[model samples]
Target: MMFMKSIFALAAFATAVYAQSVTIAAPVEGTSVTAGQNFTVDIARPNTLSPSQEVAVVIGLVSCSEAPFNGNCASFDVSQIFGTILYNGPYTPTLHNGPSPDFIDFYQNFTLTVPSWFTPGSASLNVAHVSLIGAGPFPDLEVKNITLNVVAA
Candidate 1:
């Protein structure tokens, strides 16, 4: 019994530590929107390799009343726009390691246009990111949430 408790405690601590690795900016919690209103969110990756690997970063923008089950949530295919993920491309970071540049972020302004079916009320904006190779949408996802108030169309 004691062993199980200790393991649970350790797991909780590890989750807290891991969560700090990523940060989200913009589209502040409780952001208000009407039908089809547009907004942006900035997600920062703590570390990246120089010359940024040629991989596609897919952002999953969704809205839900509860858990994303059945038709409860609506997904937006915010995959790629104009050959740019979000709006920016990979470049070397000022802070480099071993003479190679470090590209560690997806800094872009993406407009999240509320879907017409997103009924007016309180909903959660679920954020997810996955890195992919060409053509394949294999998901290695990390997710977060923000509160929102969706208004009428």
Candidate 2:
């Protein structure tokens, strides 16, 4: 009986540890574009455990400059145009001490309404990290992925 009780306690602890993680999938990059063309960027969060918990996503337009070193690029002049909180609907599962109980999905579309201010060349559509807070015991959360591209309009 004592051995059986210890095994059960261990299983419960492991389940709790696995239940509290928030994962943000990568954003799919759209194709090339003209200066005045309308473009759409699809941002998806396929899996979210704590959908009840709030998160802030900041999207910006930035210029990527090549560095002296190989395989390295630098970003500059981050212009913030879109920043908002994603509210996972009530049907979305709340983190109750295990991996996200349900799959959460959403998207955002951006059009190039601003006039050209930079030289004719290539730039990047950057999605800053997803900021997660007040979710269980985790103090903060951040995730990074590849930057998308935008041509001169």
lDDT of each: 0.48, 0.39
Tens-place lDDT digits, model 1, residues 5-54: 99997896555435323345567877788866666765554443222222
TM-scores for the candidates = 0.48, 0.45
**Candidate 1 Cα RMSD (Å):** 10.1
Clashing pairs in 2: 18-99, 19-97, 19-98, 19-99, 35-153, 49-100
lDDT of 2 by residue, 42-91 (tens): 44433334422435444444334333212222333233322121222221
What is residue 111's positional error in candidate 2, in angstroms? 4.1
Q: In candidate 1, list every pair of residues with a backbone clash.
A: none
Which 10 successive residues of model 1 have the least lDDT summed? 76-85
RMSD of each: 10.1, 8.9
